[model samples]
Target: MNELNGYDIEDLEVGMTASFSKTITEADIILFAGASGDNNAIHINEDFARTTPFGGRIAHGFLTASTISAAIANRLPGPGTIYIAQEMRFVGPVRPGDTVTARVTVKQLTRERSRAVLLTICSVGDKVVVEGEATVRTTSRARREATV
Candidate 1:
């Protein structure tokens, strides 16, 4: 697994942590809107968004949540991980130019030892913007060794 730059299931432990960060940009909002087909006014239309409860343009909630995905893929479990389930709660709005950091902590492994359950959180500075849990399966050392 190290050769492939990913964590095998045997490499994970409860409380292990990792993170990824990106600054949300105007282009990111527009691109996400186009790529995801979420053409909502709050994301692309500032004037229209101004009247909404957010008071101005805000990035899509899933866009913020995607940062969490990034942490799981690129940090903790690295490349060979598959999502089994994810539950996210969008707690705060993210505006353009905000530097969002997504962090994942190993909460516990499933009883079967085949999956990892992680506490996922995305935040801007000290304010938590999104929080969740993610269940993912990573390559097993046994499987990798057998394949080799």
Candidate 2:
């Protein structure tokens, strides 16, 4: 859960990276389905999933997307990261037991406003499960130093 902690705006920098890994579980899929109200057969009913093109159950897209939060909190903007925007593409299915890793790379910095543009990626093994971009604003490192 340490990976789920975030930091303030003043403590971020461009080129920072944060990565987190977690193993998918059936319970996670079920819980996500209930919490997100996305009870698509592929994520809930195994029998119904058997008829789908994938022929098996898969995790909800947002469940996979949620993994990015951990990376951002623990790595990118550790304590006070604020989410301004996110764009995600679901590229692959996430099955139970697959260990997925989510990573965020700070791609651009807008120093005047204390904002960062980041590229976020989630993968299982060699296959990418999701990719997207996110915007975060954090306390300026200079501001924190000045206060101290």
lDDT of each: 0.90, 0.82
State the number of backbone clashes in model 1.
Answer: 0
Point out where model 2 deviates above 4 Å: 1-13, 142-148
Q: 84-124, model 1: which lDDT tens digit per residue?
A: 99998999999999999999999988634569999999999
lDDT of 2 at 4: 39
- The 10-residue segment with the lowest total lDDT in model 2: 1-10
How do the predictions measure up, each by TM-score?
0.95, 0.87
Model 1 TM-score (2 dp): 0.95
Runs off by more than 4 Å, candidate 1: 1-5, 111-113
Query: At residue 60, what lDDT does model 2 achieve?
Result: 86
In model 1, pairs of residues that clash are none
Worst 10 residues of 1 by lDDT: 1-10
